[model samples]
Target: VVDLEAIADQSYQFVEWTGDNGTIADTTANATTITMNGSYTIRAEFDITTYTLDISSTAVGNVIEPGEGSFEYDDGTMVNLEAVADEGYHFVEWTGDNGTIGDLTANETTVEMLNDYTITAEFEINTYSLTVDSTAGGNVIEPGEGTFEYDDGTMVNLEAAADEGYHFVEWTGDNGTIGDVTANETTVEMLNDYTITAEFEINTYTLDISSTEGGSVVAPGEGSFEYEHGTTVDLEAVADTGYHFVEWTGDNGTIGDVTANETTVEIFEDYTITAEIEEMAAEYYQLTVEVEGNGTVDIDPDQNEYEEGTEVTLTAIPDADWNFGEWTGDHKGEDAEINVTMDEDKNITAVFEEEPTDEYELTIAIEGNGTTEPGEGTHTYENGTAVTVEATPADGWQFSEWTGDVPEGQENETEITITMDMDKVVTANFEEEDTTLFDVGITNYDEEVVKGENVTIEYTVHNPTDKVVTEDIILIIDGERVVVQEDVTLEPGQEVTLEYQWEAEDAGEFTISTDDEDDPDPVTVTVEEEDDGMDMMLIGGIVAVIVIILALIGYMMMKGGEGSETEMEEETEEMEELETDEEEETDEEELDEEDETMEEGSDEEEMEEETEEEEMVDEDIEEEL
Candidate 1:
């Protein structure tokens, strides 16, 4: 048997042995045995080892050359790497170790592999652009008016400056890009490519105010003034002595009150206004006074002539049993005393009449569902006076007659005349008509309602007889006709539902019924005030606050109790410490007493021993003798 072996050096690998003359057991194995049947020769093969190269890239990009995945290359081999990025993306750098990159920033680069290497081509998103512009009256000051570049989510400071006579309004752009649209100086987040504009407006207007020779402008004073557009400016003109202000005339802009010396003007465009004034002329006019009836007229200053624009006071005095009625002629009024302007010739008359000596009372009364003229009350009238009374009946009722002190022939008339020779009482009577053609009954209605809400009353009207009947169905509230369904026709034995809506304007009890006499029962509704939720909420809030306060007090009381307990515990501990100290002192005293007693006992024992020794010495002496 012959043994075969193949050995490989460092960084090299062994391959299968190759030979033609021997019977090898395994030719592919590194160590094997061969039978030596004949003379044979074998050779070992080796090869250089190759390392794995892994190439990859980040998202949105990929390696184009020597593409992705594992690749085997010999040592010291240089591999070209190229990274292609998608739109809106760019190559950033190359990452990973075990390899030498030619250029980290360059998209197309090379990597030399010395061992197993993992190379990653890094990619980054591109930066966006921002373009800013302005209107005619403004200019962007920050990052000055041109296109700017920024990364995503970059907040850029923006500022707009307005020219003279102008004001910055706002910054307008794509929605949600600007931090504050109404501020002149604000910021914008660059989310994407964006275009924004700064808006401004020319707002000021000039107002030139002047006045005629007799007057001068006082308010917003006479010279030229500048005001913002749509500004209301007050204008006042004061006339010199003996001069009168006429009217205000303006070439442009709206004057609130043009005829008044003090007014306001709304400025839109440039405006020029003048306050016209005229000199007052002095003239005198004659005052003529006339008296009618039994009144005497007296004029202040008692002058027959007065200057123009002078106010004269006139007093009217009547004789006994007479009263001043009114004034007539140039000035007409019912005032007993009056002031008249003497601009021209003035003539005024004071008329008076004697008071009536005999006056009577007329009392009016109503019967049934009707109202009378002058109402139901007592009215005063002169003696032998005639009073006319008219009666108007409610729905389903007619005026029947006039009774009580009415003229005999006029008793049957709706309108009657009553002579008030003395204290008299008259009555206007109304009677219900036979207009009930249907058997009406309330079917549905609400008995309780809220104020300011609507209430619906539904009633059914049926024709009970074998005939077609047409009648008016009226809704009455508190004996007054509120609404009427006119000319409702129903066939025999037919029924229909009629509905009436009434707004409950006030909180009260109201009775609702139909005018049909067949409807005997009236539905009464009680309107209640609407419940206020705010009141309940306020009460609940107050209760909650009170409960919170009570809880706080209880907590404080609990804390106080804990503090008291702690104090008591501290006092108990102090007392226990005092007791321990006293016990220690007592033990020390007992030890001192024990030591003194032992010293005394020892002294006694020593004295006895000395006595025994002396006795023994004496005995010895005797024996020696």
Candidate 2:
């Protein structure tokens, strides 16, 4: 905190201190140290009063020529003004265009050229003497030269040359003597209507300034200032060739030596607010800020915010060559974290390891024609519908758990079902030979019967020799087994019925077998219903005889019941009546009826008696003849 008494009433307060120019320094005399972070303040001033006037020079004789050397006061001379500073601090160097041959130390100091390179003087704090007339009352300067036509001196330092009862206003000379001489002006005018009288007074410093880059044996990086009477420290820019320091007097305390040409003094962000009570409107105070140095990066941060037990990937890429370094933050449950390091900077990445997993299948298969010539049959662990392969370890071999796809869960001799869904060319593979075999006959049945009752079905037999043989036979119906008939004897061509009860109720029109249904004799039977009409013919003959017998017996009973013999007697009587009624010579039919009756009766002998009586009588007469 720089508290300069001169600036205690001003809006801006100046801090002070001094240091080597490029090295470092505290800016204010009241400031003690540079805070670890953020802006600082500085105030600057340049004193021009009470400076030196030196003449280390060269002179040449004035000659009347076209191109000659320099002189002054019109003695036909042309000369250069070459002076150096002698008042001992940082000074603004002067050249020929402005005032020359001396130092300038007032608020507006002036050094004029005079008398052909022969006159030079300096102004320090002294008596204020305003004299136009050449008369001295005290330390007031009085003119020593007489017979003055026009004098060129107007005003003197009023405070440095003031007598007891005089505040010198002008330079008054005798009645017509002109005075044009002022202390801090560049050129004097011709004496007009001015007087030259001597008056004097005393005073102190007029304003305030500080020399922060003084040249008082200051090191190459320090800053300071110099003055004639009192002192006020100022901010002077750092110079590379010399040291920089600060000059102060009165009672503006608190300045220190520090590092960094630009140092910032701050706690965190602290600021002071001071105000006076007599306020009509508000006011604001400010300072000019300077960012003085280079090196172009800034990094300041707080705590990290993430999880404590999660795996994450971190990648770092730098603009420089950096080695493997230690981890600063947390690494949850990461496997190779903290234990691993990156030896280089690149687009680097990492991965984690995994564990191994175990799987097993079985199959049953038939190879070859699958009909009369089945070649090989097998049960295997590897063969399946999808053909899964298993690592089947043999009896003495120890099993190794597989890491890839297997047939089953490492089980051996498992039964698997397989079917022939289509006509296929198949091969049965196995790890070892099977102990059992399947017996399927290749014999087929051929039966010859009449066309309405029996159809001719052809068959074949296989694996047979010329002997009485015995084996198990499997007979299949449709696609399943209808019979498994075993143990049979046959004399080659001789055959017997392979009787099978019809378990199937419906007599289906059947394809007795597939071409691959058997390797043996294949049989098929067609049963039929028995005949009716022959018994009807035999019962019809017996019914015809019983009808003929009843008809003959009825004809004899009708003749007896009608009385036909009595009718015959009555007919004989009628014939006699007819003969009686007939004439002897004309009725032949009547006589025939009478003859027929008399033949049936007693007529001829008795009729002859009458004829004899009549003959006796005639005999006597005939005797007379």
Candidate 3:
């Protein structure tokens, strides 16, 4: 068992034990006992002084902590209380109290409950509603529509935004102390509620233009009208009939290049724009040029129209085979280049007359001793002019042929006609005729004869025509007249030989020719030294004896008789003739063998002559030494 005792102080007293222990000796005792069957504590109970704490709030708030109605605590015990305001209110202050409190105005406070006390927490309203509105074209941006409540000294931001084609102007109605009154967005300290509106207006501007009397302004319609501010309008000026654009005038709003037909203008304010034009006038005169006579006219700076008093240089261009003639009609000069002034409409004719038919030089040339009737000189004639030219042979010459630009059929004619269309050279060729009465020729005494031998020189005359010709034929040998026939009449196609025999006394080269000038050409002959070893007289005598014997034998063979005995004699004669023939063949064989020795002897003589010449040269060398 345990025992407890109660002790009391001046301000506190021990309270009774309120526990479920084993047992209490006294039911309301300050001193108590508990049976300790296992373990127990005995609590002492005492009755001391205590108080009740009553906390209350004003109409819009409540005491939240420490219970709302009352709180019981022993004397000198501490109690903490809190007061909270309702939706639109705020806590003010604590009014009644019988204990010590921490603060009166604070939402939360502490007090010492020494006795039963009652305290009332006072609260006041601290909120204001904010109302926002705007004009029909715009609305508020922040803390936007409807009512809004805020605490005292709370900051509220208001912004107004305008719709398209409109702008914000100002704010109105129940507005608090605004931060920026002129700005679309502003702020306010909400000590009280606010209701505000944003005003807006539409944007616009003015445009004005005009045109002159001669032409009408096509673009912008020449009027004073309104346009949206800061807008770029296209401005143009179009010319009417017989007029053109000059420039634009007035207004500070400038267009690109005032004289241009199309331009632009920026409208910021009212402006008066004018498009000025000028009247049209003709500035150029007409000029016309014509050509004639197979030619063309070329003009410098050629055009259909030319400025008044302008001079155009005209040149006459002629075709091939033509020439520039005089210039007539509006230009009166023979010069190829002429100038015409364009004072009025000009009609000029470049008179290019046909040039005089081109004349070419026809040259007549004579060849081989001849002359021409047209003369041997270059002569000029018009184109296609017929010229007659005749060729005549001089003296013993006759016209043979023509050459060099002679017509085909007239080439052989002594007379011909030529056209002088172009430059030409003609040659009249001639040849000598056969007018010689007789053909006389002379031959040398011998082709090759030895000195001191008899040589016969022959002269031949021929008459090759159908008639008889009479002439004196003279033959010349070695430049001397050796034979002549005076008054020799040769019948047609007759040939006569007149010969002269003489002893060649010298060894030399000789020429033989006729005395006729037409047959002056000649032949040559050579005479050599005679061979002394030959016996001509003896050989001649032997040949004569042989010829006589052969003649007698031939006579015997020709005789004939009339009997059998005569036949026998004839047979015997035939036998004798055969014998004679055999003997002649033997003699001819002997002669041929002897002739070979003659050629051998001649060769030896030539070798001896060469040896003699060499010896002579050696002697000469010795004498010189």
Please give the CA lDDT of all the candidate structures: 0.79, 0.31, 0.73
Stretches of candidate 3 above 4 Å error? 1-29, 32-203, 280-303, 306-625
Worst 10 residues of 1 by lDDT: 589-598
Deviating ranges (above 4 Å) for candidate 1: 1-166, 169-213, 216-227, 232-241, 246-264, 269-274, 283-296, 300-306, 325-625
What tens digits encode model 2's per-residue C-alpha lDDT throughout 1-625?
A: 2233223322233444433212224344443434333344433432222222233222221111211233223222233433333322122333334344334332223444333232332222222222233334333333332223332334322212445433334343432332233331122233343334443322222222222332321221232222222222222223222232222222223222222222221111111211111212222222111111211111111113222222223432222332222222322333323222222221222222221111112222422212111223332332223443323334323323332122344323222223322222233323432211233333343232222333333333343345555544345565564444555545544444443322333333433552343344455554333222212322332233233334333543554546466653453353343323222212432343333224412323432432453344345324422
| Better lDDT candidate (1, 2) | 1
Local error of candidate 3 at residue 316 (angstroms): 27
Candidate 2's C-alpha runs over 4 A off are 1-461, 464-471, 478-480, 487-508, 518-527, 534-625
Q: Put down candidate 3 lDDT per residue, 189-221, tens digits, no spaces.
A: 887777777777665777777888777766778
In model 3, the clashing pairs are 14-46, 15-46, 16-45, 30-45, 92-123
TM-score of 2: 0.17
What lDDT would candidate 3 get against the real structure? 0.73
* Residue 225, model 2: Cα distance from true site in angstroms: 79
Specify the highest-lDDT model's number: 1
Output the better candidate (1/3) by lDDT: 1
Find the candidate with the highest TM-score and give its number.
1
lDDT for 208 in candidate 2 is 27
Q: Write the per-residue lDDT of candidate 1 for residues 1-625, one digit (tens) a residue.
A: 8888888886777877787625888887878888888777778878887889888899989999899999998777888888999876889998887248888888888887678888888998878889999999879999889899997678899989998667898887763788888888889887789888999998988999999999899998888999987788998999876688999876733998888889899887899999999998887899888988997988996786898778899999999988898998999999888998777898889999877559988989888998988888999998878888888999879989888888878888887877776788888888988767677778898788778767878888899989999887777786787645778899999999888777788899998877754557888999998666433433443354345335444644565655566655654464455445434444543453334224445435544543454344345334423
- What is residue 315's positional error in candidate 3, in angstroms? 27
